[model samples]
Target: MAATALLLSLAGCQCSPSESDTASKGTNAFQRVTGDDVESDRSQWDQVYAQDAYVYGKEPAEVLVENIDILPVGRALDIAMGEGRNAVFLAKKGFVVDGVDLSEVAIRKAKRLAKEAKVEIATINADLNTYQIKPETYEVILNIQYLQRSLIPQIKRGLKRGGVVVFENQTVDQLKLPNSQGIRRDYLLNVGELKELFKDFKILHYSEKNDGKQAVARLVAMKP
Candidate 1:
């Protein structure tokens, strides 16, 4: 199989069936936005992360696990870092890590997990849609599962020269799966779209594949 067609298991794709139901029911509130419109999204995620168990499990994404050695260790940022599995992993590997998430509950859980692992990671609770990443700041950045096209420029600007970005998210083919309901098409990457997004960067790894459960796009690229 070609590199982009290889099937590989990745973590943090979605919550379990029970967990999904819980998030829809809105069982918890974390950061309360005063406006009725602003709080819905955050509240839903807060509910998901509020559970006793981690919604996406504690293991870091398989892509990060496989490609860590090639990435330069320095200031690392995890975007939309729900519960901080990746952040903690990078910290253990000796990176100064910062994790940002909209859910305060998730941030709290991430801190707790870091404490349990005897590592320290700075956690920021902010909406990625409005969050501003400092220009040319991070040596490594991880954008796993979460997709925000509007944030792409910020991601590019946030990296210093030669900085690498590791990203993985569901592809449009994911709708072919049996359990793909409620997953919005707008959120899915189109075929070859992932590569096209980082066309200017030097791509180290790129793949689009179906692994029985879901179809996903994975990419590792370095700034010029």
Candidate 2:
């Protein structure tokens, strides 16, 4: 039964911290995060937020803003939410948003910023590898500037019918650029890889763009 399957998926979700989950700012303060390990990544991101009121700035990503009209304005999830810029933006647009990240410190900052924005959003501090995404529960899911290939299936299952997913992250081509420092090879998507992953879905838009020093892939797809 579909209900049974959904229940099983939810049961498989993980939320505990791993042994590598210790707190320390990484050697390179500006080092890139590849979703390699939750603890070290969390520590680095926490430090980033502690120093900047909004590390990526207060605006929603351009991809999200440009495609905002097509997104269903209901339950939404923001993966690896960082300082909650996108999550807060969605909340303001009347979406009930839930944000998840490995950094408790980042979540704290997100909650504070949400309050400042006069919008409410639920937040969870959990490692992405262990975090269980509730199945078919959200009308929209936003994954920006983070990539975890293993999470693709979960992302598909986490969306409600007619729901959309907006994802953007660096591509393997980024490795060729000198400015693309600290980005791990495995974290970058190969050309056509992002679209191929969601082949069965209705892809509204997809592209690979050279943004300064990094080559990035962006996609907007909907569940059938």
Candidate 3:
């Protein structure tokens, strides 16, 4: 079932050129993708990758690093793990890792980075909404820079008992600040939304803030 979900998720990928347009005449390039049309096919990621290099530069996410001690030496999962940065990092730290995303191109790059990092990580190209996340399976799960509200419950269920989830992503308020045109409210999270959505679990940490153009909410929650 998970395999089927992975295959079907990439069936309609499309990346609109306008989706990559400039926010102003003389500003930095920002593609704040909006809309609930996450039904994108593989070609959409291909378009984005064609314009950039593999791995999108490899480095562990800081949030994951800071909370590394909480992660048991067991299987870990990475949701929307573009370029494999976090997965490879976990592998290096002695964890069996599985990375999932909707972008084949991104998965390829992630593989390349994993090889470059001399670490092994299983990469699954699948959309989160349809993917069958096995319950209580992983000791650590990472969700960064991606938002799909429906996946919250499954995420809690997918963790091993006492497992931890580190989530970091932009919020709706991010665009309210100055120079916020590169952000999309649809693609961003809302304040307290994370806590409310995953209220059944135990929240270890939570923060909502806008740092420059990045409006983000981060939480380290545990499944009882």
lDDT of 2 by residue, 139-168 (tens): 999988777777899999999999999998
Worst 10 residues of 3 by lDDT: 4-13
Off by over 4 Å in 3: 1-29, 33-41, 51-56
Cα lDDT, all candidates: 0.78, 0.75, 0.69
Q: What is the TM-score of each candidate against the true structure?
A: 0.85, 0.83, 0.80
The local lDDT score (0 to 100) that residue 167 gets in candidate 3 is 92
Predicted candidate 3 versus true structure: per-residue lDDT over 95-142, tens digit per residue: 999999777878888888888888899989876668878988998888
Ranked by lDDT from best down, the candidates are 1, 2, 3
Give lDDT tens digits, candidate 1, residues 96-146: 999998779989999999999999999898767677999999999999877
Quickly count the clashes in candidate 1: 0
| Off by more than 4 A, model 2 | 1-30, 34-37
Winner of 1 and 2 under lDDT = 1
Q: Give the 10-residue window scoring lowest on summed lDDT in candidate 1.
A: 1-10
TM-score of candidate 2 versus the correct structure, residues matched by position: 0.83
